[model samples]
Target: MATIFTRIVEGEIPSYKIAETDQFLSFLDVRPTVEGHTLCIIKREVDYYFDLTDDELAGLTLFSKRVAQALKQVIDCKRIAVAVLGLEVPHTHVHLIPVRSEQDFHLGRSIEVSPERMEEIAAAVRAALEG
Candidate 1:
């Protein structure tokens, strides 16, 4: 069976997409740590991030930077923090959070957003990419 991330990549699953290229996709995290938290994933389903090619790795970071900058333009944050913890899904992904303090990126004390809030956040983040 394809992983959930692969399904999203293949459009079998829907997402509040932020940015995409031939090799990467950026979207809002459904269970966001912060209001504008985003998920940046490689097009390929690599379990570990370091398994990606140098070019792919660099491109992913650069692509994420573009999205982070856009998030900053629209979301309130002191800075945008990026985290990589490949334990949840079989695919490699970076979690980008709009942070206000050292604890803002604290994966332990993160906020659980409601579905309605997720929709609202998705709209804002999507607009940020366009704006």
Candidate 2:
């Protein structure tokens, strides 16, 4: 069975996309810790982050950096925090969270964001990436 992230990449599941490349995809986290929390994932179905090859790891990091840069431009935060926890989804992914302080980076908590607001944030990040 394909993981949810793979489903998103395959168009089986809808996502508020922030950015994409031939090998990677970044999109808004529906259950976000913050308003601008995003997920960057490798298109391939890799179970663990450490299981990825050096090149794959580097590519994902570079791809995520671009998304983080764009995310920072649109979201008001001190820094974009990165986290990798593969237990929940069984796919290699990175969380790029916009944080005002250290407390904002907590992975155990999430905030409710409406669909309209998610799209708006996604659009702003996309525009930032493009501009």
User: Largest TM-score belongs to which candidate?
Assistant: 2
Per-residue lDDT over 1-131 for candidate 1, one digit per residue giving the tens place of the 0 to 100 score: 78889999999999878888899998888777778888999989899999999998999999889888888887888999989998888899988899899777866555677777777777777777777
lDDT of each: 0.86, 0.96
Off by over 4 Å in 1: none
- Give lDDT tens digits, candidate 2, residues 73-109: 9999999999999889999999999999999999999
TM-score for each predicted model, relative to the true structure: 0.89, 0.98
Error of 1 at 120 (Å): 3.4
The true-versus-predicted C-alpha distance at residue 84 of model 2, in Å, is 0.8
Which pairs clash (backbone N, Cα, C closer than 3 Å) in model 2?
Answer: none
Candidate 2 TM-score, C-alpha based: 0.98
- Model 2: residues >4 Å from true position, as ranges? none
